[model samples]
Target: MRIGIFGTGGMADALGAHWARAGHELLVSGRSAENAAALANRLGAATGTWPEVAAAADVLLLALPAGAVLDVLAASGPLTGKVLVDCTNDPALTGAPVASRIASASPGAHVVKAFNLAPTDIWQLTPPAWEGRPLSVPLCGDDPAALAAVGTLVRDIGATPVAGGGLDRAALLEATAAFVIGLWFAGEDAQAILAPVG
Candidate 1:
């Protein structure tokens, strides 16, 4: 699979490394050509302009800031048929999901909301786990093939993919991230809130 990373930040470094190690071809691009090149070098991937990367990738990971995502997408040219995995979160708790916005911006792209729940360090884990259990990632997307593609990427990074309903439900996942991440910032065990149901 050819994966394009649209950011040069920690999220890109963490996840891109896994995909590269998993033998998927990667092309990284961002606002900063130098940073993008550096990240690409570190991951043994290639660097290109945003539009070039957009054109070349089978899957594109939006590891960019939530505020800048739409603008960047608009500049990336056509994204028809691309599996766009949105890993960005709007801390403002905006009513609409970023994935939905991306879908709106790129008419034919398959947008999947995923890999936004955890921190970069967690994703850096060989297989993020708690005790003896592998971490379960919740995925929200309308297209089956898109979800399946993102699911394979999630597993490549050592996480299980949990079906989180369709694109309409993605806002719930974003809200949950805001809430849980807030709890984490308060130095609380966010996972403690989710006791197993009988």
Candidate 2:
């Protein structure tokens, strides 16, 4: 897969590094050309402008800040039929779900909400695991093909993909992220809140 990383932050570095190791071609671009080039060099990938990367890649990862998503997506060229993986989380974002918002802004792009539940350090783990179990990633998207593509990427990083229903449920995932992240910061075991059902 040809993956386009639309940021230079920690999420971009961690995820991009894994995908690069998995033999995917990567194009990295960010607000800072120098930063993008640096990240690209680190991942052994290429650097390009947002529009150029958007045009050239099969799948695009929006590892950018939630506040910058719409503006950056708008600036990127038309994303018709592209698989767009949204990993942004913002507790303050009201109104629509971030992935839904991205879908609306891109028109024809297939948007999948994923990689938002955990911290960047977790993703840095080679196939994140706990208690000898592979970490399960939840994904929300409307298109089957798009979901499958993102699921493959999730597996590429050595995690299991859990079907999280459609795009309408994305806000639920976002809310869960906010809740669990808050718990983590509070030094609580967020996982303990949910027990295995009989």
Model 1 global lDDT (CA atoms, 0 to 1):
0.92
Q: Write the per-residue lDDT of candidate 1 for residues 1-198, one digit (tens) a residue.
A: 999999999999999999999999999999999999899999999999889999999999999999999999989999999999999999887657788888899999999999888888888888777776788999999899999999999899888999999988889889889999999999999989998979
- Lowest summed lDDT over 10 consecutive residues: which window, candidate 2? 126-135
User: After superposing candidate 2, which stretches have Cα over 4 Å from the reference?
Assistant: none
Error of 2 at 192 (Å): 1.2
All candidates: TM-score: 0.97, 0.96
Q: Give me the displacement of residue 112 in model 2, in angstroms.
A: 0.6
Q: Model 1, which residues run further than 4 Å from truth?
A: none
Q: Enumerate residue pairs that collide in model 1.
A: none
RMSD of 2: 1.1
Q: Please list the Cα RMSD from the true structure of every candidate, rounded to 1 decimal place.
A: 1.1, 1.1
